[model samples]
Target: MEGNMNYFEIFKDVSVVFFIAIPPWLALRKYLKNYLNRAFLTIFFITYIIATLLTQNVFPFILVVLCFYFAIKMKDNFEVLYYLRPIKEKKTEIILYCLFFRFIIYIINVFYASLLEYVGIKVKAQDIYEIFLNAGWIKVIFLFAMTVVFAPIVEEFTFRHILYRGLSKKIGKQLSAALTSFLFALIHYNLAGFVSFFGIGIYNCYLYEKYGYRAAVVNHFIFNFISVLLILLIKIFNIPTVMT
Candidate 1:
């Protein structure tokens, strides 16, 4: 295993990933222009990582809530979700169907979790639980916003609207969706969350393919809401599980 990195890893390693990746990304930008803005992504990654580490205690919650507020407002007025799908589907139908897909994903996650445990994929449940102990109301509220609002808007825009639509033109949709999902999961920096989040990516892709951004966003929201709620519920209720 690689040695665990310190704050320098967040600072320098993150910079290296982009600085090295930039030239090829720019060269390919002519092809995948709409997929990612090179400048914005580099800025976003750098700013986000540094800010995330620095703002760890509580203030970041305030910023995330702001992101949620703006996302909801834009989605309501601009109809960004409507434009990204097939020619005829209504946003209402897309959201409902997406929830249906989200329910299915929850079942899949449970089964996969069992399989991982059976094979002795040891993960420190207590470590994750401690993050919750540090969490106060601000963090809880932020978790809700992160799940039910912010994630839906950002992830659907990233994976469904941008990643899938851009890549499918070159590779087939099948390969593009799978690869994008894998990459998406890999970026989250959690060993235990990889499978469940990858499952999220696949389900989000399906929602996008079947309907549009509306469907994808709705599914993403449902998945996050459920996951966050479960974690909160376990801790809140003081259930005697391995988590703490």
Candidate 2:
């Protein structure tokens, strides 16, 4: 039964990847003909694959930095940095909204874990969390940088600025946001956290549409910063609990 369940989980993940990723690619194939769009997508997927295959926690940080460097070199072609400007107004509002969403994500995580436990299945800590728990202080700081700074930049540029924008042009914005959110959640490959990620993805899309890409990026940074703080607290206190 355990083996069967593993197979089922694998099947579900593959199905999600196919349904969420392939259809959008097909729809946006022509749109991606633009050099900047194609390049950004390529960078995003390559980094994603490398980050997945390489178990070392620091690789993600390195890959994202490389991605950002390439993006900077191409700034003249796409004005990429314009979207990365810090949010100058309504800082408090953005922070509050992020905190609210973080709370909702926590509730969703707890409910999912409880449901899995009720079914006699133990919930596993997310891979990044495990990395944090096991790593030395120096490595943990690198992981924190990846989480709080670099990840948000690369992920927002790819998902919100590239994917969401391209998909919006092909489909309507509403459907585009939904599809982008679905792909964002699947890319993380955390079944137990899918709903929470999806919810945040939707919120990020909304921020992008309403306030431009900077808002989305800031939202992601705040969300991750809070998560990293909690993880640091856990490590400092030697908490026995695992977070999904």
Against the true structure, whose lDDT is highest?
2
Instruction: Write down the lDDT of every candidate, Cα atoms only.
Output: 0.59, 0.70
Stretches > 4 Å off in candidate 2 = 1-86
Give one digit per residue, the lDDT tens place, for model 1 in 136-237.
Answer: 978777656645675566555556666676788899888988988887776555656676678778877876776666666677777667666767887788
**All predictions: root-mean-square deviation over Cα?**
7.4, 6.4
TM-score of each: 0.64, 0.68
| Model 1 spans > 4 angstroms off | 1-3, 7-82, 85-92, 124-130, 242-244
The alpha-carbon deviation from the true structure for residue 28 of candidate 2, after best TM-score superposition, in angstroms, is 19
* Per-residue lDDT of candidate 2, residues 192-225 (tens digit): 7777778878999998876767788788888788
